[model samples]
Target: DSIRVGDSLTSADRPVSEPISTPPLAPPTLSCLFGANNGPLVGQEGSIVTSSKIRARLISETDNNVTLTVESCIEDAEKTLVFGRGELQLGILIEQMRREGYEIIISPPAVVTNICPDTGKKTEPYEEVVVDVDAEYSGSVIDSLTGARKGVLVEMMDDASDGKTRLLFEIPSRGLLGFHSDIATVTRGTAVVHHCYLDDREYAGALGSKLERGKLVSCELGKATLFALASIAERGTLFVEPGDMVYPGMIIGEYNKVTGGDLEVNPVRAKATTNIRTVLKEEKAYLPPPKRLTVEELIGYMNDDEIIEVTPKSVRLRKVELDSGARERAARVKKKRLQAQMQKKK
Candidate 1:
């Protein structure tokens, strides 16, 4: 007789067959999940708008998907770890979640590491990096990767068609930070980089240093005028145009000259007007457009002492030590500490 769990089954006039038993399905090993953020874009695009809804959807996903598992982590309130194939696979999941109208806070993608219990030693994940780029770009890629202290080039192959080269390296997770932008700039958007996990290994030395230059800061808050930018642009590249919002301590752009110590210029002040007017028409002013930094660029460009402020609508780069006086004080203290450590080693 066929019977449902909740309903009663009655016997018919004809003989009934015995019920058949089935084995339970095993749970899935793979899982895909997302995290939360306080960005303004949340709740704007999807049916599951609330955080709770998002959470529920994730939990419900494991119901029929026997191979997958979902659970919350103990460390962070706003984070969830979804173990899956690799970063590329996880990246696809993140894109889907975002398209569904969920605002998320994604830390730069990293591989989960483990410790060897017997040796009590730390180990990290690594990847095989394959880069194909123009011959000119090969040097910059090598320099950049080596600077990051991430990987070593294993081989190089020449591409005869366009005078390009293919380079391979074994890179650590930390070293790959911000490599995307660097590759784009070096190859002029012609390089192709592919990477996947290789194996666990001992920690590599410190990755390359952060940006060496200081920001072009603004001293006041107001609309930027052409005259103000003209003067400031002489110091370095300008990040703002005339009539743009200016705030004190805001980084306007990067400087072109490396020798000049950190320079800060006010962009809000207007040009002075003259009382006496000439008969000839006033000369027109032309200003160059400023370079805008995206989230990835801001992250890649920031120094260890800085943090990238990410909001739904905007991304701003600010010093970790917000106050100028405080930042100077911290730098001095850090310098003294490093000097003391060096002396101790001697």
Candidate 2:
């Protein structure tokens, strides 16, 4: 219907709007790499291949578990190929797939690597990173990129107005896993970063984990109590408030640097009602705000044995094996492997 210059549509004349607005279709992510979904599939393990641009290859399947290598597509850096893309994407995809009647498990994002046939050397993905930061924070950016992230300085210019500095680096894609949130912290939230794939390069040496100290893991599943948090406050920084929900194996806080190993304590422990005097004594105690890490920061916090569980309702940092016993077993196995390697080096 055509409207005259000043004409207004009445309620009856207007088109009916649905209660929930339809969300726009999502643009493809930078790139996606899927692995570590070792769970049984209900349907014939073949639909995801035909319905979308995702590429999947069945690694193994049995009555109990199905493993697949799923790759996501996106325009490459040169805009020449859609061969690369995901940690958050994978988690969200798996959650959506489950909602859509599929059974799957997916791991966090990781750098995909290939071997150079001629040299028989391992090569990993690299990225072209462009960072714009305040002149004062430029040094921190440069140090972080060039030293910790295995980045090579491409260029640095202070030509921009407003005391801004521009930095360019070619860094391993893996090095960027948790850099987004960290740069902000280092620069006091004064840095702007942009990055994309830059072909595979020679393998960088082993990089260290992001966590400087061990984490505070919740031993019991329940809402966190203030008394419990007060008890744990001296242990390390809490990542949850007094009333937040926590589950077994979920990380609730950081551990003291001096005592560095995952410490399991009950966040959900209730204060005994008989201790009113003690409560009053402890009530005035200052509780530092817990850290609110994003999915990327949580990714940084991950050890090889942990996973960040993301869903529509919540993002929970959890051990890969929820069972405490299983995690300990895995840790012991890892320690033995490390010891054996050290012996070999000796």
Global lDDT of each model? 0.63, 0.63
Per-residue error (Å), model 2, residue 194? 1.2
Candidate 2 lDDT over 100-188, as tens digits, reads 43323223455667899989999887888999999999988988888767889999999656899999999887787667777988999
TM-score: which candidate is best? 2
Q: What are the per-model numbers of colliding residue pairs?
A: 4, 4
RMSD of each: 8.6, 12.7
Model 2, stretches more than 4 Å misplaced? 1-106, 208-211, 275-286
List, residue by residue over 222-277, the lDDT tens digit for candidate 1: 77888888878877777678876656556777777664545667787776788988
TM-score of each: 0.66, 0.69
Mind sharing the TM-score for model 1? 0.66
Model 1 clash tally? 4
